[model samples]
Target: MSASTEQPEHLRRSLSNRHLQLIALGGAIGTGLFMGSGKTISLAGPSILLVYLIIGVMLFFVMRAMGELLLSNLQYKSFIDFSTDLLGPWAGFFCGWTYWFCWIVTAIAEVIAIAAYVQFWLPHLAPWIPALLCVLLLLSLNLATVKMFGELEFWFALIKIVAIVALVVVGFALVAWGFHSPAGNKATLANLWNDGGLFPHGLSGFFAGFQIAVFAFVGIELVGTTAAETADPRRNLPKAINSIPVRIIIFYVLALAAIMAVTPWRLVEADKSPFVELFVLAGVPAAASLINFVVLTSATSSANSGMFSTSRMLYGLADEDHAPKPFARLSKAAVPSLGLLFSCFCLLLGAALIYLVPNLLTAFTLVTTLSAVLFMFVWSLILCAYMAYRRKRPQQHADSTYKMPGGVFMCWVCLAFFAFVLVLLCLQADTRAALLASPVWFVLLGIGYALKSRRAGKPDQAGS
Candidate 1:
């Protein structure tokens, strides 16, 4: 490798407290809450709220472990950085690329979602056109500078935050004033239980909620990616992580609970956004038009986030020479231009798939499962890294100010919980297929590592 290519490219620390806070907010409130909540409510009734709480709690501990690991070593670019340091090179190789692949699948699905949402306003616009345009816009913003990414996310997250808060407040006011859903069902807190009760779907439905609710929490660990670009990682990172439980309660649980209360779970259309329906029930004029715009921005925000995170993951991989060196190149603006374009290229491939696939819906069923399974690989690695850190660096753990609670015990708990979620996923045939397909990723990565190791060793033999 040439010295120029070997030069360390530092990611600019342009993101401030507000940017970190909002990006953290954006990560937690995916379109799932705004949109997928309808399906969740339909399947599990009101128990979906508990489903969110359970997934959120397990993930919070994961974040805590991640926080402690990142803070313990300022040299760590992201959690995967520490994974390599604590575990081994192969662990880093597997985790880093797996994370990159995870986001690629996520970004592709979200861009397709953008196209779907665009149809609401432009009934004739092709899905690929909007998908392509959205990816390009995010690419340009990210290419400008890291702060541009931060500012865009700040506004995106603000929209979601304001929308959810409005839903909760208006929901309470309606309950107090006794407004009825358009269906003539009285809008009261009793709506949560008046129909068939919280567990109306039975134990089966309650567990079923986990299938989709887990997807809702997909990017919650996004704060970990911002570690390198954050202005104050030690302070900002801990603040962002410590607040996950609160965000889950407010942005997810309260938001869903309010939606179900305004319109009973039975009334929520299984395929439609309960958010738009909530306002329509309140007799808010143009409710569909208004919420459609919000959901549009919601999908755009998520796709934008996936773009930013994937580029960084590739940059980290390239820095380690596990990926092609071009990905490590930073433009004059200090952004990973090559990595951004490459990720965008993969997204374009997804666009092409959307254009050519006979049934886009069937394609996404496989994509979503692959996404969930790959993310589990990355998260489980983080827990394993934490266990390694605890055992190897007890002094560091003892001296750290932002220590993970419950010590190493929580690590096992989280791992067990993740395994259980995988079991739940396997029970469903569609997700089960993805679960099986996921091992192919590790198999491929292991093969690459073996080849790379052989090549690296040959150079030493030549030198001797």
Candidate 2:
């Protein structure tokens, strides 16, 4: 593509290598690792280790394919950008909008999490006050400039990274000294096997863990979204992607292993955060609230990320003429002002609904369920889009220095892996409900695409 054909970028390329690196960690180490790990351990026992490994390996391929694709065309902003040309305009429209919706649902969940978490500090405070305030503060930070967004994410991610490193260090000390947990379980490597062996729930339980583990990786593909606004996509993006193995090791694998070693997997609770549980263990004064503060910041961090990415996605959609024209317009600060405000409004509305709902728990579950289903669609789009890039641009592939490791073979493997996740989705009731309702979003997108194409006096284009 020539410069004449290149898409215009109004958003500033202000994010640096440090910003990108920490942003990757920020997105990866959110509520999923902090809160959801408890449930995963409860279901899969020590086998959750394998579950994280499998999902991380599969997603690494997905990111490898994405890194190659994004670097293949600097003109492309997000995965959806090239999907429009390589796949079809509809591919861009469907996946781009679906991604926006995914973040919206995720942001809502995080907002509710913030509200509930703040209650741990003030027992009688209204949920809506802190939730609305959190959204407004995050929105103001995002609206300032891309750099402000970067700064906010940097500090938030720093907290998470520091917390994880502390957890690993503290946990290892606990295990090395032979510290016994409050429940009388000894902190040792043997705890992994001493409690009914690794596969306590057998193969069935192992597969069941994927249902939750998959969503734990929802934002792992985030760097690909920063292609246009990143200072040096070639160097910084790959550095962030290359560190995935180490990240999985330290953040997910070792952290969980440390937790299980300190407190046996059998003693872990499904309903509570293992971090808080362990911090509040014997001889730790006020550690529970400290961990709770970390959890609150983690939730706020996730929502902050959702706000930043969702606005950019909307801007991409509008720049491509897939969305309203105003969304493409940028502020004097070179930010997508319209898109950012719109996303923030939707977040506030969603938060308000959650606050007013008769059953806040039910609302939170519904939002999470939808987020998982749509994130699956968005990730699959990345794989399918990579496949299309490979088939359609052979010369480009041959010229590229950073290519997917297995090439086309791994693309098929990743798709098959996703198909297997869908099967697991159906095996559970919450995920099953989400799988069934998954059609509603796609159907709406299909209708919207058809109408837009009709108005354009062109036939609807479909992706292979």
TM-score of each: 0.95, 0.95
Q: Write the per-residue lDDT of candidate 2 for residues 92-131, one digit (tens) a residue.
A: 9998999999998999889988988899889799988899
Residue range 221-315, candidate 1, lDDT tens digits? 89899898898888899899988999999998988888888888887888998888778767788988888788888888888998899999999
RMSD of each: 3.3, 3.4
- For model 1, where is the 10-residue window of minimal lDDT? 1-10
Prediction 2 global C-alpha lDDT: 0.86
State the C-alpha lDDT per candidate.
0.86, 0.86
Model 1, residue pairs in steric clash:
none
- Per-residue lDDT, model 1, residue 445, is 91
Candidate 1 TM-score, C-alpha based: 0.95
Worst 10 residues of 2 by lDDT: 1-10
- Measured with C-alpha atoms, the lDDT of residue 293 in candidate 1 is 81
